[model samples]
Target: MKILIAEDDLASRKYLDKILSQYGECDLTVNGMEAVEAFLMAWDVGDPYDLICLDIMMPKVDGMRALQAIRDLEKQKGVAEADQTKIIMITALHDTEYVRNSFQKGCEAYAAKPVNTEKLIEVMRQLGLQV
Candidate 1:
């Protein structure tokens, strides 16, 4: 599986990388804009990511905006909803509003910060991604 991990905090980024690396190839991005750019480039090259783990807060675009952009791009490219890439929002924020917005914006799952590896893997499995 191809995965994209977008995170700003170095510790969280490395931690997620360690956990996710066992599952597939991971491309890391430190900001939302870069994440979007990578996503677009991958799609253009017919190498679209199967999963994207985005931090809700980041420099530049921010995860919510990035998620929306990714979904829009998929729609523009005629990717059916069932076939669109899976997105998992990762953040320290546990506010009900953030959770609701994440879902509304097309996040497949949400992982609270200090990510739980087991829970994340379970979510990946739920999404039909080989974990």
Candidate 2:
């Protein structure tokens, strides 16, 4: 499975890559805009990520906007929205409203900053993807 990771933090991106590498192929993007661009580009070439891990606070195009854009594409292109192609939102903020909004917007799961590896593993298991 190909996993796409969108995070502005270099260290965090690398950490995610390292953790997921043992599982399958990994793609990296610095910010949400880049993430969407990369996803679309890959899809256009007959490749799509099996999962996307996104950071809410990013330099260009935040996670919310990026998610909206991707949803639009999924609709426009008539692609199925499946839990198999999961989306995990990551943020440091403990804002209940934002978390609620994200879940409503169809994010599979949300993780607080300084992620708990075990919890992340559980989330992946729930998504039917394991590392």
Candidate 3:
């Protein structure tokens, strides 16, 4: 699986990369803009990501907007809903509003900050990804 991790915090970025790398190749981005750009570039090259780990708050663009843009692009490109890349919204906020917005924006899962490896893996499995 090819994974894109969009996180602004250095430690969290590294931590997630370390944890997720065991499952697949990971491309890291510092903010939402870079994330979107990377996604577009990958798509153009016919190497779209299998999963995206998006942070909720980032500079240039927020995760919610980034998620919307990606979903819209997929729709515009005529990619089927079942074929769209899986996105997991990762954030420090535990607010129900963020959780609701994430699912509404098309995220497959939501992971709170200080992510648990076991639970994350479980969610990945639930999403039908080989862990």
Candidate 4:
């Protein structure tokens, strides 16, 4: 399971990397633009990520837009819905609007800041990832 973690905060980024590395190889990005670039590069090289943990707010591009771009790219590349990478939107926000928008943008799961390892793992299992 190759995972991409897109987070702007240094501590959050390191925390996620530490937690998620147990499951698979993790590629980290500091912002949404880098995340999208990494995603596209991986796809081009035939090494697409299995999961993407995207932060809602980041520099350059926001997570919502990034998610849309990623989904659109998958569609344009003819990748079926079932084959598309699993995405989990991670944010510090407690706003319901953000949650609603995340689902509407195709995220499989949503994790709040100060993520719980157990719940995250459970969510991964629910997504069919052998974590």
Candidate 5:
């Protein structure tokens, strides 16, 4: 399975990519808009990733907006039963509202900043991914 990571911090992005690499192929992006672009590029090339991990705050575009766009595209095509991409928000924001919004926006999970590698592993397990 392929995974897409959207993070602004270079070190964090690299870390996530490294960890996820143990499981499968990984793609890294610096921001949400870049994540969107990468997703589109992959899809256009007939290869959609199995997972997308997004950071809440990012330049150009934010995670919430990017997720909405992806969801909208699915709705637009009227593929009501199409498999939806698994989205996980890996962000620093801990506000309850942001957490609430994440679920409302269809994220599979949300992790607070200073991410725990073990927690990530657990979450990936729930998603049927092993590391």
Candidate 6:
């Protein structure tokens, strides 16, 4: 499974990459703009990501906007809603608003900061990803 990990924090990103790499190829992005660009580029090249781990408070664009953009892009490409790439919102904030907005924007899951490897894997499995 191809995956994208978008986070501004170096350590968190690396930790996620290290653990998730066991599953498949992974791409890293520092901020939301890069995240969206990477996602679009992959789609354009017919190599769309299977999963996206997006951070909420990134530079340039925020995760909520990024999620909306990705969903919109999928729709523009005639990709069905059910077939859109899976997204997991990863952030430090536990605010109900963020969670609600993320789900409203089409994220498949949400992971709070200091992410748990075991729980993340469980969520991945629940999403039908062979992790």
lDDT of each: 0.95, 0.84, 0.96, 0.96, 0.84, 0.94
Per-residue lDDT of 108 in model 6 = 95
Clashes (backbone N, CA, C under 3 Å), per candidate, total 0, 0, 0, 0, 0, 0
lDDT of 3 by residue, 66-126 (tens): 9999999999999999999999999999899999989998999999989999999999999
lDDT of 6 by residue, 1-131 (tens): 99999999999999999999999999999988999999999998999999999999998998888899999888899998778898999999979999998999999999998999999999999998987
Model 4: how far is 79 from its true place, Å? 0.8
1-131 per-residue lDDT for model 1 (tens digits) = 99999999999999989999999999999999999999999998989999999999999999999999999999898999999999999999979999999999899999998888888999999999998
Candidate with more favorable, higher TM-score: 4 or 5: 4
lDDT of 2 by residue, 17-129 (tens): 88887778999998889988988997799887778898999997998777777767767777877633578999888999989988877789999988888898888988888
TM-score to native of every candidate shown: 0.98, 0.93, 0.98, 0.98, 0.91, 0.98
Summing lDDT over every window of 10 consecutive residues in candidate 2, give the lowest-scoring window: 76-85
Residue 78 miss distance in model 3 (angstroms): 0.3
Model 4 misplaced regions, further than 4 Å = none
- Candidate 3 weakest lDDT stretch, 10 residues: 30-39
Off by over 4 Å in 1: none
| Pairs that clash in candidate 4 | none
Query: Model 6 residue 93 lDDT?
Result: 96
Q: List the pairs of residues colliding in candidate 5.
A: none
Native-vs-model 5 lDDT? 0.84
Cα error, residue 118 of model 4, in Å, equals: 0.4
Q: Name the weakest run of 10 consecutive residues (lDDT summed) in model 5.
A: 73-82
